[model samples]
Target: MKNTTLYKKFFVAINGSNSEQRPLSIALSGGVDSVVLLHLCYTLREQMPGWVIEAIYIDHGLSVDSDSWRAFCQRLCESLSIDFKTASVEVKAKARHSLEAQARDARYAALDSLAMANSMIVLGQHGDDQLETFLLRLKRGSGLDGLASMRAQRILDSGRVCIRPLLNASREDIEAFARMFAIEHIEDHSNKDDRFDRNFLRNQVIPLFKSRFNGFLQSVLRSIELLQQQQSLIEELTLQDLQTCCSEQGQLDLQRLGALSQLRQANVVRSWLASFNEKMPSKVQLEQLLHQALTSKQDAQINIVMGKGCVKKHRGFLYFVIAQDPPQPCVDVALAPITLNDGRALIVEHGVGVRAPNNNERISVQFGLLSSKIRPRNKPGRNAVKHWLKEAGVPSWQRAHVPLIFYDEQLVQIVGYYFEHSMYVPQQGVRWEVVDGE
Candidate 1:
């Protein structure tokens, strides 16, 4: 390769890029690191075989020179024989999204929109950059997981993998390579402004520490590597535990979780929640979640509304789900219909499905149907099953998620509970099945 990275290891790791079915897309800020990565990928295009390189420039439109940066990137890509792309994105600094977060999100969103399925987006993050991130997390008083920071293979929301090829390379190496190649990288004046935390670390804070203690950078980086190793092990254990404790509908076991060490709980919760990719619960919210979920009365209804959804406890199962009411599965119930597709038919209600095997014993789960004409008697049938369960102590908040079968305008069966005597399967072989409810 005409232009290789300072360390051949990063290129090999990136060239391996793990998933080649996902092609390569580069974030070209026209900085030394990004430009070097773009050049390296372009030079090794033949070696990569089927790899496709797209240089994407995200102009935040925060400055007057932003347009010039885009043009520079386009020209640079043209010279390098790489496809060029540019996205004009708005960076919001509202209270909800801090400036740093907003810019990063917007940039990635733009990349995701442009990337093909399972494609990989390569970042210019090298060893020094990773060290800075680790230090930032350390300053926040986070544990090992936080210090682990970025990984080599993290899936993005767009279903693309964000791969950092230069993760183990340093700034000095990248700058040297850029100058050697006469690569024309834009020098953003903001880098000199020192208003950014990263810039402060690079310019002032880091130099002071370096003067006081030689090799401080490498020492701190070594500590981060150790933390990364520990964090990876914790994640592996947490996942194994999750698989063992997961409920049928992806619910977690609070008691099982509480039994683990407190530090392990944080690791488990973060890994578990991230598995769903939901807006994560904060540290305080996570603590509260553990407390209420494990310690609250077994039957007590615990509903936590945070981020993009809610976590609820129902019938000894823990649910982390979308905050919105999912439309009832569009299904109509039929009496004496035992099975569908070689599987038991489900009775559908508000937001749930009840599957009662025709020949199986009367299980612990209750069931029901909705019918204006059918009035099933409970132990003491009076009003409707709806009214009966509500009065019998089903919490109002929990009612919405419970399966309540409706026959037309009337409520007949409630799955898992009891069938309406009027609408029960008339014969021994007769069975009622739940389907999607409108």
Candidate 2:
């Protein structure tokens, strides 16, 4: 390949200096594929003036060789006169997904951070990958959206646009380019381990088919392209349909939703939250969400958490919630200070606090209290909440969703949604407010 032409194509795919004043950060994994990507990107500056480029490598810390691979990548970047960075990630099994998924998630999380405040990150996913992903999705019986496979240029969920310059290029082409440039690359021994599904498909399935069919990879690529076009149409319709069917309460309009075939309903939900490559919900979770949403009561409020995010249904439309178990659970998630030493009056809601017992009387509180100057009535009217909600006609199940403040072992307040006047904060003593959303 002509270096200048390759550079021009890659540079333009990044949208160039004219389209974006921002620089481009390329993710280099030290593999042959990414090494070629780095070389191609390095040629960009010569092809287009003012095209800034940076390279980032995330050491996932999985293999003992991770450190050496990173060091090699750093040295390669240094020799090429490109700025390089090393980012480390810890991919613990934090979700109800595969270890591979978690590691990929964590690796990207690190890369996204490495991309810095503003700038797009480039990845090296060639045509071979696009074909394998298509087959994988097909084997799983996924819809057109999944069969479509990866795109060349798509804006990631992080609000950053990721461009794959080599999407149309074959793996053989990349290796040829690498060998031509005499570029050194690391071979991950793990790729030989067929334990991974993708590896198995590449080594076993694809080879047999390739031997039988001269251009199977090209055929698969073309098939995926066709599926992608059809998926584009479906995605367009699904987004528009969701807008009309989802209400302000973040719940779906069952009346409108029920009008569609069961398959269409599923498509609408999946497409609303996804496009060509937005991570689709798992089959089990998708089925559960569809069933619960379709079969539940008209006034039901539903919340299902999966992965790093969650889906909530309130009123008649679905809402996305981003809150999670805090990064430092002990420090940030646990806001209460446990308990105060001695008779120090503990502010009931601050996780933990302490203060001396006061003899003062006359308390002013909103939670409905008697002349008895208790700072907080101990769990009063908690049982009455179900009755109050019943009186107010709130369902039996929803009372739990409402935030209820607790004083140590006792329920002190049922915030915004409800408050039992019987349990009021006391006057002429330490003050405490009902806890709400954190």
Candidate 3:
């Protein structure tokens, strides 16, 4: 109850010496932990005049009392004369993850959208939440990154840094503070539902461990810190390896990646995918990907579906391409610019000092052109589109999406790859080019 000094010191340490200069946004869930957090920050605001404190409540709309929680949060914020905002998000479960995860995702997304660039967003995850996360991830067979558990501070994908100032504080600390201050907070009945893994861990497993081991939570915290240190070293090594294995287009060099130890390979791939904001592949999926990359023949094609995208290997490189719905077949290309389904546009340029297509010639843009015998400019022999794409180092998975330009059914040019020489007259007229649309 008299731990206000501890709360002040923790917040000051996490926020650094310039804590008073920047804006602080507290994520208020109308729970005891967050209510305590908000109260502490509100009190701190008086001592630090430069601090602009506000609160945000995210309503997932999954519970009947969500609206009541929002109103309670708003009233609390109003009583403290603090700015407040609310966001409603839909939580839908996906095949690969759980509803709890989906809801968390939605909650964070809403927070991210509401946060300003470079601002610090504070969350109410205390030691208990950290322990629960560690246990859950351990059960799921997570790697070192997962085992490291929640960080006290981390930068989110939205560029806002999230700081858990209460990470070192126990749930009991928060409850005591709330009770001492007579803080009013909403209670979510779902927290006690053992159907959720985290709830089960919190209500059952954690209690059993606490009863059996006098300082089990502290031991787990120490282990998490050690894992975090190890994970940091791995990340440093991954950065170095990425510099050597990543291409100009951000594709991973399969040859370079294959040369690494299996563990290193997985690390590099994980780092590569993380750069693209893609989800980390499961352990089994990652091993399968590495095996295929290392053992596949030079001519062998590889494609593995990932979250909302796929990993592709062609020639000696691996690339991640987002999944797109199939485009309608063969959209005609007129003299004017025409946009394709994939947001790339084909434009006909005339009188630009190159040979233009003949007046009788017709041009159309299409996908999956499989015909051969189309020779690229300055190349000796005709080759199939597949062979040409392969020779050009295009991944097989991407070939189907490449726009092929045809002159009356004769494949004249591959939009981004090759141009057929016969279609152009030297030192005269018009041409066509494909460009990415905004």
Candidate 4:
């Protein structure tokens, strides 16, 4: 591509729908691709007047030359009078997960924290990187969603926008732009190690493919676009299926879900997990989940480990409960919202539910009192809290999270489930609402 054409592409990407006037944070690695991207943004600065342009280098600290690369990026940014920042991340590798993936997750998290909100995080990934990603997913037996590859623009779960202006440009196009402008860049020595799948592809597999078929990359790009379109249709169908099978509390109704074909059932589950931003389960894990959901005994407890949470079944419904810190042992209850250490809050409102505590009474909320007994609104007598939880169909693992409201030393309310029979009022009462923290 010509210099002017490349500039126009960057301009259009930054000026795309719902993206105008947002600051740009370029992911600089002191490599040709990113260096060229920074140069383009710097040259096009006049076109995007009043927009902030900066470069951020994330040091994974895995390579011996990591410090030098950060220095290089800092100098380059200074030469162009752009803001420069660096962040170091610890890549915590887990079993069955690749180091690359761990580093990527850490890098993205750091960027999310350091970048300005409502701004764009520009990446320097090109068409060659897209081809490598498609092949990598194919090697892992990924379905259509994975094979669809990267997009020019996407919004992260954190609501920050990311754009890849170089996604459509070929590697040769970027190199030519760099050479024509005599731009200097550094290379990471780790790229020479074929132990990495991407390195192996770039050095051995892709060159042969390019030589064998002159338009191989273009053909793959076209296929990716078609797959993306097909994936979009599937997403729409999954959403429609979800409406029938998913409850307002984000629980999946097994009866409704099982009515669909096995393929549709899996599709709905994947979409359901995606709605909660949960990592997609592997094929084997997904099959096991479906099997347990369909054939397990009605009273049998079901708990499947997912990313940071567990999938549990209770009363014919499946819920994804993330692990969270337990709430404080006790908290004073008042008119203002009471925020818990965990991502939860209780808003006590004046409504028809439980009777307001008397002026002399000390109102507080407590957790984990399974042995305590209380009489539900119309119940004959007090029953153990554990029995009340079981009767209410609360999952065994989640029974401890139920917030108990105390009037002095007596249990008067189960925040979300019921009110004490003696404390219940028909006219004026305090109703409690639970607000989930993100």
Best by TM-score: 4
Q: Give the residue spans of candidate 2 off by over 4 A.
A: 1-12, 16-18, 93-96, 271-438
TM-score of each: 0.80, 0.70, 0.85, 0.86
lDDT tens digits by residue: candidate 1, 1-438: 354546475567775765444567888998888988888877667666677778889988788999888888999888778888888999867975668778888888998887656568888888778877887887888766677887766777656678888776767778888888787788888878788888888778777877899877678767777877887787788888777667766877777776788877776777777877877677888899888887889788888886777788866667876654422432443443323332335532332222333332232222332222234444545455556566555544545444545544434455555455655543442223446433
In candidate 4, what are the lDDT values of residues 328-351, reduced to their tens digit?
A: 865555667888888788887786
Give the C-alpha lDDT of model 4: 0.86
Clashes of each: 27, 22, 2, 0
Model 2: residue 258 alpha-carbon error in angstroms? 1.9
Model 3, range 281-356, lDDT digits (tens) per residue? 8888989999988898976778898876888877778888887754555544566877777787767766532355
The Cα RMSD of model 2 versus the native structure comes to 8.1
Give lDDT: candidate 2, residue 397. 39
Question: What is the per-residue lDDT of model 2 for residues 1-438, given as tens digits with 9 covering 90 to 100?
Answer: 444444455556656432755777889999998998888877766555687888999988888999889899999989978889888888786566778778877877787877866877888988888877887888889776767888877665687777787777778778877777788999999988898889998889888988899988888878888888898888777777877777664546767887888777888877655532335787788899888877888678777875556666655455566553211111111233322122122233422222312333222222222121223233343345445544555433344443334333334344444433444434432223333323
Record all residue pairs in model 4 with backbone atoms less than 3 Å apart, i.e. clashing. none
Order of candidate numbers by TM-score, starting with the best:
4, 3, 1, 2
Q: Which rank order by lDDT, best down to worst?
A: 4, 3, 1, 2
Stretch of 10 with least lDDT, candidate 4: 1-10
Model 4, runs deviating above 4 Å:
1-5, 17-19, 92-94, 324-326, 331-365, 375-377, 405-438
Task: For each candidate in the order shown, give its overall lDDT on alpha carbons.
Answer: 0.69, 0.66, 0.80, 0.86
